[model samples]
Target chain A: MRITALAGGVGGARFLRGLRTHLDRSPGLADTELTIIGNTGDDISLFGLRVCPDLDTLLYTLGGGIHEGQGWGRADESHRLLGELAAYGAVPQWFTLGDLDFGTHVVRSQWLGQGLSLSEVTTRLARRWGLPDQRITLLPMSDSPVETHVVVEDEDGQRAIHFQEWWVRYQASIPAQRFQAVGMDRATAAPGVLDAIRGADVVLLPPSNPVVSIGIILGVPGVRDALRGTTAPVVGVSPLIGGMPVRGHADACLAAIGVESTAAAVAGLYEDFLDGWLVAPEDEASVRLPRATVRSRPLLMTDTDAAADIAGAALDLARELAA
Target chain B: MRITALAGGVGGARFLRGLRTHLDRSPGLADTELTIIGNTGDDISLFGLRVCPDLDTLLYTLGGGIHEGQGWGRADESHRLLGELAAYGAVPQWFTLGDLDFGTHVVRSQWLGQGLSLSEVTTRLARRWGLPDQRITLLPMSDSPVETHVVVEDEDGQRAIHFQEWWVRYQASIPAQRFQAVGMDRATAAPGVLDAIRGADVVLLPPSNPVVSIGIILGVPGVRDALRGTTAPVVGVSPLIGGMPVRGHADACLAAIGVESTAAAVAGLYEDFLDGWLVAPEDEASVRLPRATVRSRPLLMTDTDAAADIAGAALDLARELAA
Candidate 1:
């Protein structure tokens, strides 16, 4: 069986890691292959090196190199490189890149500068993380550069800044007027991305930001169409629990797009294709969909086992909908 | 007094540091401004980051951040970044880059990618190293991209590889057939390079590699013309001690250009513009120049004081020639 998922940065990575653990432990599903389509809208060029935050998080978290406490960067990482960069007064000091993490961006930039596509680069990076050995193939959503920019009003008076500045720098305190994927019109789905969605036995959406993470990926040409056309049961795990995001500024992101910060509203964003929805126990009663089956579960993701339980519940919901 | 010097990597940087020390201690020379024209032929793009080895060595040495034992790179540096790059199987694993050194390359690449001239980028980097505070101005030989490629024959047959690969990786052992500055045909002298030489009260050449270092700088259009036309006495400290380079592969580099490994032969290369020559005491009798005054000194830069003494001798020779 093949399971395809669309992921964002931290939350999505953590949930996918849990799902991998669950699959490995299960008897019949142990041989199931997982294909992860990572959102690259958050990609930014920092210090002249291309940085793919979401893809790197998935690589680290799934490969057992993630800083558990931070849920993103590498474990046992040092910041001496960053300290030197700061000494030089290089800009955008808000986003932290550890010395170990810098290795990823450097090589990615080098390969990309050499004319390799983002998919090829991500495949190489995944190999280094031993993802192929675990029957996991990680790919960027699109090979073309697609950066999400946020429009905000501040002392500077209405300007568009890179999504990272608004998210990592400002902590999203300033109200965002809207989010724009700067190159979405030109971005075609990466090789195997459409096939993964159209041919999967089951499709899962991890608890990534609905407004920015998964939404930006869905904006890719033919991606939404592929989802709606696929015969597989599409299951989504809500990023929000009890009307609040478990991590990141999903509420602010939703506000920018004029969507309510609730599991139902989040599910509505995927209503065209979503056949199964997994929500937190407290929010399950409020989520009612005409075309999708709704289920309730404790979704704190307090530990690997708790996260596995949540992921296992979502898979079970998908299986029920398929049956 | 205004002093100008042409420099390379380790040896030149150490000599200049010593010169700076000497100038600071000397009564009248304390107020003197030093302008250094650094060779860019050895520059390489490692991992897509612009690595200006000669300029960085000068920065670290003059700024008191150099590793005294190694004569180059940052003191108290970590190799975590390189270690990670190696793990990713990035090529050219021979030339090591410490984490701190990577900071320099990262920012330089970033600025250069943003369309800043190499001279402007070097200025910003020099500012961080407090070169302005020391009243020291460092300029690259050419703002245009100029890389020295060496033609060598081994298992790969006759092909041109980057100068750094020949110097650092192979230790200059392959017996270079010839040295070619790849972009020198289209290259023009960087702003202030020619002016620094023409306007200097004294022009000194440190114990840098005569062929690859100083020789490459002279290849820039109008630089040698500036030296030939300048009124300032051009004095040079020999890199050789008893027909042998104190450090690096100066002999190999000289041999590549069909020149002998002798102070006399080196002085002959600059006979048209050289007004003063300081050689090792052992070579004083043999080094006979028709126009340039030949002098002898203990040229081994064993320590700061030794280097300073040699630099002072070169200045005294320049002053005597002027008188």
Candidate 2:
């Protein structure tokens, strides 16, 4: 079986990791080829080094190197590099990059500077994480630099800042007027991105931020079209639980797009192609859809086993729809 | 009073740091402005980030962050970043950069990418190291990217490799045919480099590598002329003791250029402009010069205090020459 999933940072990475765990334990499913299309809209250049937050998160989480407590970055991390950068008074001190994590950015920047596309650089990075050995192929949504910029109004007046500045620095407290994928128009889907979706047995959207993660991937020129055109059943696990995000600022993100913070509203965003929707038990009654089957399950993903069960439920729903 | 010095990496940084210490304790000399023109030919792009071995050595030493045991790099440094890079199979893993040291390259690369000249970047780095507060100005020999490439014949056949690969990786064991300053033809002296040389009350040469360090600096346009035209007496501390260097592969570097590893031979390279030459007592007998004063002293910088005394002796010689 082939599974293609669109993922963001922590939440998406966690869900996909759980999906991998589920596949590994299930008989006959161990050979499944999983192609993850990671959101690159969160990509930022810090200290002239390219940082792909979502892709790195997936790499770390899946490779067993993740800071489990924080749910992103590397385990056994040190901040000495960051401490030195701070002492030098280099700007944007808010987004903390560990010494180990810096290794990724430095090599990625080096490879990219050497004229390799993001896909090529990411492939090299993934190889280091043993992603290929696990039958995982993680590709950025697009090779073109697509950064999500958040438009926010504050005492300083209206301004557009990189999504990370708003998300990591300001904690998204600053009301975002809207989100902008700065280079989406020029971005073409990374090689295999469209094919992964079009050729997959099942397509899953993890519990990633709707506005900046999956939504940003959807904005990639041919991505949404592929989803609508693909014959595979498209399943989505709701990022929200009882009108609030399980993680991150999905509610605030939905508000910026004028969408209600509800499972039904999120499903509505993908109504054209969505085949099945997985929601929290509390949100089951309110998330009814005419074209898609809505299923209720405990979506908290409190642990890896819980996450595996949730992911398995989503896959089951997709399989039922396909049948 | 204005004092300028030419420098390389470890030896130069140690001597200059000692010079600063000596100046601080000497009455009336405490206020003297010291300008250091550091060699940049040793600069290399590692992992696609600018790595200035000599300049960083100067900064870390003068800033009180140097690894005392190694006489270069940051104290209490961790190799976590380098470890990660190695895991990713990034090339040129021979020259290791510590986590704390990476902070310097990252910011410098970022600033350079933003179109800041190397001199400007060095100034900012110096500020963080409190060089400005100590009235110390560290200038790269030239703003242009001049790299020293060593031509060596090995089992791989004759090829020109980066100076660092020869020096650090091979430990200069591979006999060098000759040394080439790859971009020196188009290199101009960085701003203030010529001024520092010509306008100083005293000019001193630290016991750095003669062929690769001080020699490369002299290759910059107008620098040799400025040294010759300067009203200030030019004094040099011999890098060799009894025809042998105390540290580093200076003899091998000298051999590459067909120059004998002797104090007198080294002074001959500066014969046109040298005013005073400081050599070890054993080498004093052989280093007689017609135009330049020869002074004998213990050339070994065994510790900080010894380095200070040696630097102070060089200054005294310059003062005597001026008088």
Candidate 3:
């Protein structure tokens, strides 16, 4: 089956890792072509270099070169460049460029500047890293620039902060009033983005930030409409399991969007498009959706094996919906 | 007394290292200010990050953090970031970037993007690196972008390549017809470049690439004018010891510019502005100069002490001219 997944950064990367592992292990699922539509809202320009955080995280993790300890950047990372940057009084000191990761950004930025679309650049990067050919395709949400900005009221006053500062710099400590994907209103889905969704036999939404990750992708023109009208079952895994996020500042983002941190609220957000919803067994009572048939399963991806098992369960639910 | 020095990358950095030692040990030069005018001809935009090769070399060397073995970059350097860059297929792979040195480039690029002058950025970077207050003022030749391009013709075709590609990638293996500083004609000298020369008590040119390094600096508007009019004696140490460069592809550059790789040929280039010329003792028999008084010395800087001795001999020549 051709399964397409929509992803953010950490959570999306983790879920994709599991899905990849599951496909590799399952005898019948070996032919599954996985196309990942990644959110580029978290992308930013730093030191005059374009940095796509989510795309890099996905690339590094899938390529087997991720820094396991930091859970981001390349393995055996060095801070020599970052130290020099700091010494030069570079602002927004919190967002660091690991030496190994800087290379990726530099290459990506160079290719982008040379008039290659994000999708084309991504394919080239993936090919260079020796990623499995034709089995998995990683697509940025749009070729156009779209930033996730957070409206916050700090002691200094109200202002819109870039997503990186709101997340990495402030660590989400301040009260955020709303999360806005700045240019999403005018952004058309990158070439092949909507097509990937329409062509897939199954579409899986991993437990990623709804307001920024999948939400930003859906916010792109015609993307949500395509997903809603697709004949294939669109399944979503709850970002909230037992009233808490699996990782990251999802709770804060959830609060910013005024959604209670619960599986039901998350399911409700995707209700119109979701044909199936998977929630952790502990949050079985919270699974209430009108359009989607909700199923409760063991959803904690604590390890690679556990993650694969979770992915398998989701695929099984999708198969049941197909039946 | 205030001294001005013209420099390139490794050789220039080494000479300055020795010069600093000499000045530090001299009782009469206890309060002397040293201003270094560094060559930015080797500067290139890699992956869109501005890298000033010669300036970083000088900074790392004078700041007591240079890689002793390489005579460039920082000691205890790591290639973690560079390895990652390669993994992403960055072009011009021959010019390696150590993790520590990358920090300097990142900071400078960041500041440059924010509209800071190269001189101002250099000062801030030098301060951050704990360079002694007022001990040395490093100046780039021009704030405007100027890249040294070598016009090479081979059996198949002919094209002008960037200095980095010619030196690092091809290692100057090809025969070159000419050397051109692509933007020099319209470029103005960087702020404080002329002022440093105008205010100097003595001006010394290190054994750097005469054609690309010192030559490019002179090509900048007002630089040669400042040197010609300065009351301070302008003296140059021969980069060509016998009939060859001590390091780098200076010989190829010299050939490209139709100048023989000889001490006298190098000294002749600065004849109009120079007051004294320092050539290696071996090349004294071949040396001939009318505009400047020629002096013979052991010019090879084998170690810090040797470098200091060379600096001392050059300064002594300047002192003799003043007397």
Q: Which of the numbered candidates is closest to the native, going by highest lDDT?
A: 2
lDDT of each: 0.93, 0.94, 0.86
Q: How far is A310's C-alpha from truth in model 2 (Å)?
A: 1.0
Better of 2 and 3 by lDDT: 2
TM-score of 3: 0.94
Off by over 4 Å in 3: A132-134, B131-134
lDDT of 2 by residue, B1-323 (tens): 99999999999998998899899999999999999999999999999899999999999999999999998888998899999999999977889899999999999999999999999999999999999999999999989999999999989999999999999999999999999999999999999999998899999999999999999999999999999999999999999999998988999988888899999999999999999999999998898798899999998888899999999999999999999
| Candidate 1 segments exceeding 4 Å error | none
Model 3, B118-179: lDDT tens digits are 87888888886656563888888888889999888887699999988888888999988887
How is the predicted docking of candidate 1 categorized under the CAPRI scheme?
Answer: high
The TM-score of candidate 1's chain A against the true chain A comes to 0.99
Question: TM-score for each prediction?
Answer: 0.98, 0.99, 0.94
TM-score, second chain, candidate 2: 0.99
Which pairs in model 1 have colliding backbones? none
Best by TM-score: 2
DockQ (C-alpha based) per candidate is: 0.88, 0.92, 0.69
Clashes of 1: 0
